[model samples]
Target: MELGTSLEKRKVPNMLKRILQYDVQLTKKFVDLALRTTTLKSLRNHAKLFEVSCHGIVWLACWLSFIWLFNNKELYQLQVNMFIALILDIVVIAVIKAFVRRRRPVPMNKLMELGPDKFSFPSGHTSRAVLVAFILICLNPISIIFYPPLLAWVTAVSISRVLQERHYLLDVVCGAGVGLLEGLFMALIWFSQSASASILSSLSDEKLDGGEYHV
Candidate 1:
């Protein structure tokens, strides 16, 4: 069983790498077409705004605001878990980018300002965006209401990473997957603790209300 599990793990990465290779070719063609077609002056100007949104400072400020707002202990824990997940995503992306050591697309000036990140196997911006969006969507009771606009923003962020030439299509795709996995991991840990606490609280309430005495 262990051998089979190990084999499956090895196969999965190999499969994903093959998919990335094909995706790169498709993305190159698509990006070429997009660049030629996107001639609108007004639209071009807005790309910088999208680029600015991807920076670390913007996310840091947003997280700080959330930390300030969620003062309740339970809510505070949730926010902290999310913050940790974002940090994990960043660290994982940094390590993977270093290991992959993939080169960025040339003519660096065409990329959005702030130059380019050192390597580009996976997009940190796309990952962080997806991580934040996924956590918010899952944690909120009114996620249905948030879904449409939130997904639009997520899609825009992913596309921007590609169009700006900061990442290939596969990088954004893989980054999104990684972000989701991290979010789910944190959610499970947080919720499990919450469930256990609720159970303990209920048990204590029963003992007190019933006036049960232990020898």
Candidate 2:
């Protein structure tokens, strides 16, 4: 209800809004061109391939192993950043899940035919896709190579939610917002921690020098 109301209140041009609605609906019905949500199907497939798959544990572990082999400082920074981001992702996802309890499309409108009728208002699958993609892109500028496939997968994930009667357009949009913020805030947290460590190390060096540098 809140998601729908917020979307209704947006200041979109009438024609564009109508066009968008039609596009979304048309995309939803095209089973031949897309995959709909199914725990045993689309979502699971992404979990196998997408970064941050399997609740992000797989992504983190894989990144760590790769980083250890490559030993790049910049990659290390991003790993730290995404580590923070994943934590924020968990916090935001948990809070939203509890606060905005909306039924899935199937329950809200019985006539809607789809699969995976569960949880609305911030699709978890969308959240995972967005956060993982955000982190991967930021970690390496060349990660742009993954852009097309990553974006396609994210689009597919969002479409699956709608087609599967699991979420509304608004839910997916807001979930993307939350996921993006998760990466941003996580980067901030990493910078702060990195700064603190630097400061602490500097103080230790000073102490070891007997309080001052001996020229």
Task: Estimate the lDDT of model 1.
Answer: 0.68
Displacement of the residue 137 alpha carbon in candidate 2, Å: 2.8
Give the alpha carbon lDDT tens digit for every residue of 32-59 in model 1.
Answer: 7776675422333455677677666677
Model 2 spans with C-alpha error above 4 angstroms: 1-74, 107-118, 138-140, 190-215
**lDDT for every model?**
0.68, 0.59
lDDT of candidate 2 over 79-119, digit per residue (tens): 45555566667667767877765555542346554444345
Give candidate 1 misplaced runs (Cα > 4 Å): 1-24, 36-45, 69-74, 108-116, 140-143, 191-215
Global CA lDDT computed for model 2? 0.59
